[model samples]
Target chain A: MINRHKNLREKKGNFWEERLGLRAIINFLRQKKVPLSEHTIWLYTGSLILLFLAVQVITGIVLALYYKPTVAEAHASVRRIMTEIPLGWIIRSVHFWSATGMIATVFVHMISIWLLKSYRRPRELTWMTGVFLLIITLGFGFSGYLLPWDSLSLAATKVGTDIPRVIPLIGGWISKFLRGGEDVGADTLTRFYLFHICLLPLMIFLLIGFHIFLIQKLGISHPLKYEMRGIKVPEIPFWPDFVLREARVWLIALGVLITVAIFFPRSLGPQADLMAPTPAGIKPEWYFLFLFQTLKLFPSQIIFISGETLAILIILLFLGLFFFLPLIDNQPARKKGKIITAISVIIIIYAIAMTIWSLFE
Target chain B: MKFKYSCLSRRRFLSWLGGGWLATFVCSLIYPLFKAITPPYREPDEVVLLIKEVIELQPNSVKYFSWGIKPGILKRNDDGQLIAFVGVCTHLDCNVQYLPEKRKFFCACHEGWYDENGLNIAGPPPKPLRRLFVYEESDHLIIRREEKA
Candidate 1:
């Protein structure tokens, strides 16, 4: 009887082990923490991104239940949710505000690493993966903007899709593919919906997995001062130090988001009327406001090519430079230089100028 | 061992308590703020319309009139009896305009068509025209603005 009891206890232990997988992972993390590295900070950042992504996905799915894809019904359905469905406006507000907040957080996270010179040798792949993630984040915003099918969304989409039309050889084809037709209509909404909810999401998931994997493989980048110490600093455990800090940041973010959602829920405007002339002062989401305003500054025509074409060329050149930035600065500098500083300053000025122009002009 | 592990530092406990309180306070503040921004709900009310005395609604003619922010149209048929219908089309709720020459209420949205009696004649409308309660009062036509049964 005693022998039988011992076997039963062993079986119970195995069952418990399978059920507490997180505990096992946490134990492993605890064991792996090095003594002197700032692993805690990177872990916190990663955790916060994960938490925000969770919020985005959950709120997005809820909003999707009531969202209509057709232009005719889309605006009405959104309005219905605001007025009829219980807490629907709050859900939508959370999704919208969270999306904007996530983009801001990701940008800050990227710039912080860059300023800290953490994107150095042996971490180029990490930086590249991050850039890809940034692209996907922007993709999320662009596709999401059209779901409401408001007049502003419609006009912005028209201006946005035109950017690809300026590509030298395949610009027109790219624009056509993106718009799914010659003009913005049901087809455009369907295509954007698919990209936003399906294709880009899959790509983002894969890239995020790869990003985390690369980070783990390379280990957290040590502070600049620690690089010359000959001995690598040991990392702290992710649990109590990192996760706890992350929870605080997340709580703060949630507080701010809820406040914004409550005070300023997403706007609903007059339903989109295609036959009606486009309204004045139509602008894209704040993130794209700068680009929208940029397109407006160009003259109606540019050297026989349309003004839109010239604008597209300029944007493409800018994107090309952005993607190839690592290759441009071949020097092994630890801090900012004249060239880097100049580029950074120019970008800041451009962003500010476009924002101001969007508001005034 | 579990008891020892469960115990938190005083500093950590204080911070957690402070954070929790702050979050609750902010959440409470937000609830009222959301209520303040939402538009006040107004009950749909009955509208009394004067059919003949106020407007010239002729035979085979339709006249659009507003009833307390809700628009309704009065149409006089060949028999000279006035028939009233909500101006908003059943399809996507765009206001329909009476094309006097065409003798039909035409919705610009997707080219929806409704006849003289406001019946859905063409397009993707799933239902017929929504009729309002109409009665002649004091030599005038009045329409109750409640939703059609």
Candidate 2:
């Protein structure tokens, strides 16, 4: 049997030879196994989130083919997709929902890791990189919002772009660059499209590589408290163990996204009427509604300053605090403290409250 | 020495055989898994409409006809011949109107202009008005409008 198999391999030649080479890589991976059990499900969660991001990139590229970036052409192009292009609606819908999915998964991944205290010790850099990734993901959503160039999109863009305008001396300049001029125009759409499709994705790819490399290097973190039994924790290779679980989660996520896309394909309201009065009930995407509502909750003027400006300041300050959290909360012990728990509860309450406010407002 | 060599080679062969199966399984699963998650595309049918009777639509006369999801407009030219165009303008795609005094299909959006024949004459219009497939069907006007593909 051995002789016959060897002869068959010889007949197959280089293709079989390549397979032989992969054996060495597989052996290396096997030797570096970090213990994975059902308890450490967060690892699989992170992997699933990355998988969704990959899906987003692939669908985004396909949608870009039919999407136009010019202000004059943008809305018309979207209409063409609905009316003329083959399967154009499906392509656009996938791109739309996948973006929402990517952000949703990222948020879940972040909160799970934070709750698990997986960001402590060796994983501090991982946590920081994730924070950066979250900001970039939001940037992706914001820039992509204006591509449709309809009334709601335009209003949302105006409200969103204004958030960055509270950065003191640089606020006006940043808004100008973001809008590609004084207001949303041909240059604005083109700039946003380039950023959304090119710059942000490139950054995400590089950061994701680093993120994965760090995960492999550091190995999966065990649950906050776990004891090794006498028989030793049964270890499984990540390729099959963690990956198979991730595939199941991905399938479920895909099913939900498709159901939503088919039932509620992203809408295209009337072409943006600049001369007409701003439409009522204007709001941002669901994810950002919390912040939008928070901004609205403020008084017309806070200490003689515009409410919008003050709200912007508060958001920036919160972001600044998030970025420097590792440095600020550097404790030698891995145990959670009262301070961290209190802060976490406050954040949860604030997010929930703002979300409810947004719905009502 | 020969015995030792054979043992090492056997182990290597088994490792290679196992690795080959695993790689094939993973690669095959990934492609279909990705495809299953992707949204499927469906093409809509194309529609065309034609004019049958020249209703002496006076200059600047606006009449709405069911085209697709939206309505289309029919206006009489200064020559008093029935000239029909999609009410949706090519520029920014706002529904347009025939300003009888203006003698053109005037888009309220950015004030885009179109001539009697629906040729965009001014403003940011990149193309002429999309001409509907119009024809006479047994003395009645028949328009061919493409369905969503």
lDDT of 1 by residue, A259-332 (tens): 89879999887877777788986777777777778877899897788887788788778777666565654443
Model 2 DockQ vs. reference: 0.04
Calculate DockQ per candidate and list them: 0.04, 0.04
> Which window of 10 residues has the lowest lDDT sum in candidate 2 chain B?
B43-52
Per residue, candidate 2 scores C-alpha lDDT tens digits across A283-311 of: 88888977988887888887889888888
Candidate 2: regions farther than 4 A off: A1-20, A31-39, A227-235, A332-336, B1-149
Angstrom error at residue A322, model 1: 2.4
lDDT of 1 by residue, B1-149 (tens): 34556578878999999989989876764564354334455534566655445356678887677754667777788887877777887888888888878877888987898877777888866666677777776766667655446
For model 2 the TM-score comes to 0.67
TM-score of chain A of 2: 0.89
Q: Candidate 1: lDDT of A134? A: 85
